[model samples]
Target: MYYIGIDLGTSAVKLLLMREDGKIENVVSREYELSFPHPGYSEQNPEDWYRQTLDGLKALVSVVDPKEIGGISFGGQMHGLVALDEEDRVLRPAILWNDGRSIEEVRYLNEEVGKKVISGYTGNIAFAGFTAPKILWMKNNEPELFARIRKIMLPKDYLAYRLSGSFCTDYSDASGMLLLDVKNKCWSAEMLKLCGITEDMLPKLYESYETVGYLKPEIADSLSMRHDVVIAAGAGDNAAAAVGTGTVGRNKCNISLGTSGTIFITADSFCVDSNNALHAFAHADGHFHLMGCMLSAASCNKWWMDNILKTDRYAKEQTGIVRLGENHVYFLPYLMGERSPWNDPMARGAFIGMSLSTSRADMTQAVLEGVAFATRDMYEAAGSAGITPERTMICGGGARSPLWRKMISNILNISIDIPACEEGPGIGGAMLAMVADGKYSTVEEAAAAIVAVKSTCEPEPELVKKYEERYQSFRKLYPALKTVYGEL
Candidate 1:
């Protein structure tokens, strides 16, 4: 049997074809555009996502025997608000998770509504990017459009709904909306009231591996696949990526160094941080996980190397740096503001302690180390909640850098493993499809059988010690600059 995993990302929809035996047969990607209608606001059309996904599926299924295909699933960008009217037309371009238009709404939720009350109800505080804030933004600014909202959906759920004609979502993706009563895996009534929405607007929730329904006859015919192709309720991009890296069950960890950085740690039981610093979300494996995200991770390096330094050879830039933690130069990677621990939109990027003698190598090293230090900020927050992992699986574009990987390992004082296949969320979405098709017994079984760790990066004791001190200094810079960020 065969399965297809669709990774609906911000830029493209990546389709992966995998056989039951764990071999990836074919992979294809189709790009889409993200529009910034105004500064700090991001949007995308749902029609574009569905159109490209259908095209990508045709290309993916064209190579293999159609009869061998079993099921399909998705791993998608989380927290984008997709709304539909009574007749099922998209109400507006989806307010993407990265959109910062909800600044006033976010403040109202966090301050006026009270952070403690929010944390108590939903196990998370409001962020400009979360679905609830975006819903509130629409409610306040676009009341006529808001009144027509009959259904509220996430990015991938829109694809699933269009495919199976089932209005469904997975627990993993729903958690990011700031609407789920995460511990209980249900929508929070209080949150619904706060956003002036009701339970009827929400979709049915399922585990990431559960099959929602089968493909529609027309979709199946267009892709030349079996009509029995099961449509599994897929996960958020990070959760699916974690599952792809085999970060399932208790005490498992995965770090993704893509455009954004995340530390995903899975658990057997539900737990929430006091301040809700780390997200308490249901995992893809029918359990729970805590995630801490840094808004800019590898993107920080990309901005420095491509825009500032005017170079595309990233490896060549890293070769000039010699020392890991000794540089006096420090960078605060709040270029896109920030999310996780500090939900401050006023936070801005800054370079601290730069001197006349600081060389180009020092500045470059600071960017790399700055991301590591920021990642460690979340690592510490996870530890505060009594969750700690001895080792973590690492993936994404930045993970390819040996120096960056080593810096992460030493700074966090934990071992980092590299997977043989860096297919990421696309592979994880496929793995969920396999499980939903009955190719695997459970998410853990699928991960154990399919995911392979090819190498490990271990931290040296002396380097870890040096980084521990540097991280201490790094933590103090943000708070001291908090007042300054407001003035600017």
Candidate 2:
């Protein structure tokens, strides 16, 4: 038997084909358009996701007997509001997790409603990237559309609805919506009232490994797949990536450097950060985890390489950077604002301490170091909560860079484990499907078998000391320019 894991991302849908024995048979990716209709606002056509997913699925199933495919699941960007009308029509373009247009609504939820009250209900405070704030933004700005909303969903659940005809989401994905009572594993009635939405508007919730339904007949036929292919309730991208990196069990950790960066820490019990810097949420492994998410990570490097440097040669560009933690130029990676620690939506990316003698390599190095510095910010937050890992598994496109991995290891002054297969959420989704199919009795068992550490990058004391000093300086930049960000 084979299983499929679909990782629906901000820029693309990545599909993976995994066998019952845990071998990855094939992987395919398809890109889609991300729209910014207004400054700080991000949107995407849900239809684009369905079309590209179908195209990618066809390619994935072509490698093996399609009839052998046993199950399918997903891992996707969380907190994107995908509302459906009475007729199941998409109410509006999905507001992505990186969108920062809900500042006013976020302020209301965090201030007017009070963080203590909101956190009591949802175990989280409001951020511009959270779905409840987006809901309020819509209700205030697009009253007609908000009134018509009949079903609300996270991004991957929208895909599940399209393929399986099931309207459901897993607890792990729903945790970011500001609508779920995360610690309780259910919708928060208080949050629903505050957002002017009903519990009925939300999808049915399930654990990440639970099978929601099998494929719809026509949709199965479209991909030449088995109609009995079970669809598992998948996870949020970070949770799914955590599963992929084997960051399950108490105190296990994984660092993901995707479009957004995250430090994921798995816990045996529900616990919240005192300052709410790290999100306390349900984990895909049926426990709990704390995650610190930053709006931009690898995207920073991509922006510099594609938009600024105008080159596709990432490796070549990185080869010239040898300064490590010694670069005088510094980059604040707030390209799409920031989350975790500082929930400032008005924050913007900037370079500090650049001089006329600053070469292209210095600026490029600054971008990489900036992300690493931001990642460490979360690591320190986790430390304050008394959850420190001796080492962490690292995944994502940015993790492919040896230079960046070294920087991350030294910046945090911890050992970094490189997964044998670093496909991130795509592989994690497949592992969840494998669990749903009964290939493993539990998610932990599946993870132990599927996730492997290929190598470990140990932090050098000298490099760690240098980065510690650099990080202190990096930390000061955000505070110094914070007020200026709002003025801008």
Candidate 3:
């Protein structure tokens, strides 16, 4: 039998078809528009996500017998607030995870409500992009819409609801919502009160691989699939990607350098970072994990290549960067206002330490190294909690660059592995569906059986030493400019 994994991403929806044995039969993706109504606000229509996913699903299953489809699940962008009215109509465009429109609300949660109190309830502090802050933004800015919210969900859960009529979410996705008591696996009463909402407004929580319901007859028929297809509650993108890379079990790690960057490390037991720098959340493997998410990663490179250089030849831009750790130029990858560590929405990107001799190659090298250095900040935060992993599975657009991967390996002084299956979250979503269909007893067993590493990048000692000295200088730039950002 075959299972389908639907990846509802920021820019598009990708649907993958795979057998129970982990052989991918077909993959299809359909693009959608992302709206930016204000300078810092990011929004998307829920209808666009559903319509494109339906198109992608038909394309994915066209080569196979639809009756062979066993189940369907998802891996999606996390923490986007998708609100539904009493009649199940979308209230507004979903406020996405990277949106920074809730700056004031975030400040209220961290400063007024207090970080110690919020962290105790949800195992995390408020970020400008998190759902809890968005919830407050709605309450303060649009009380009429806030009053009509009958159901609140993450991005993929909205898809699950549209397909299965379950109105459910998985723990891994809900963890970023700031409404879940992550350590205990339930809704946080204090947070609900803070957001002026009731528990009934939230969806029922499930483990990532648990079955929500059978797909609705009409939805299944529309895609030429079985009406009895199991609908499994899936995970947030990072956790699902971690599962795809086999970064489950105790002390496993994965680094993603996509539109956003994250360092995910799984744990059998719950652990919190004292500074609340890293998110302590539930994992898809029925365990827990620590994560550090930075707002801009590979997008920094995209901005540099597309906007500044006016060329799409990303590899060509890197080919000239010969001086790796020896470059005196530096860049700050906070174009979207950093999340992990600093948690400052006012922070802005900058280029420093440029000399008359600084060439285009030097600036390009700085942009790539800047991302690695910011990620290393999160890596060390994990170290503070005694959760250091010797190696990590690498994924997303940035992982394809050998120069970037080598920089990461030496800068963080850890090995990086490329997964044989480059599908990432989509493959992990299929693995969850496979579990729901009884192909495997657990997510861990499915991951261990399906995930494979293709190659590894090891850190060079001399290069590591040079990057370490550079990183120290890199860390200082943010602090010096932080006041300047606020003044701007």
lDDT of 2 by residue, 243-361 (tens): 98999989999999999999999899999887999899999999999999999999999999999999999999999998887899999999999998799988989999988999999
In terms of lDDT, the best-performing candidate is 3
How do the residues 281-351 of candidate 3 rate in per-residue lDDT, one tens digit apiece?
99999999999999999999999999999999999999998777898988999998999989988888899
lDDT values of the candidates?
0.92, 0.93, 0.93
lDDT score, candidate 1, position 189: 96
Clashing pairs in 2: none
The reply for model 1, stretches above 4 Å from the true place, is none
Off by over 4 Å in 3: none
Answer with 1 or 3, whichever has the higher TM-score: 3
Which 10-residue span in candidate 3 carries the lowest summed lDDT? 218-227
Name the runs in model 2 displaced over 4 angstroms.
Answer: none
- For residue 334, give model 1's deviation from the true position in Å: 1.0
Better model by lDDT, 1 or 3?
Answer: 3
Model 1 steric clash pairs: none
Ranking by lDDT: 3, 2, 1
lDDT of 3: 0.93
Quote the positional error of residue 54 for candidate 3 in Å.
0.3
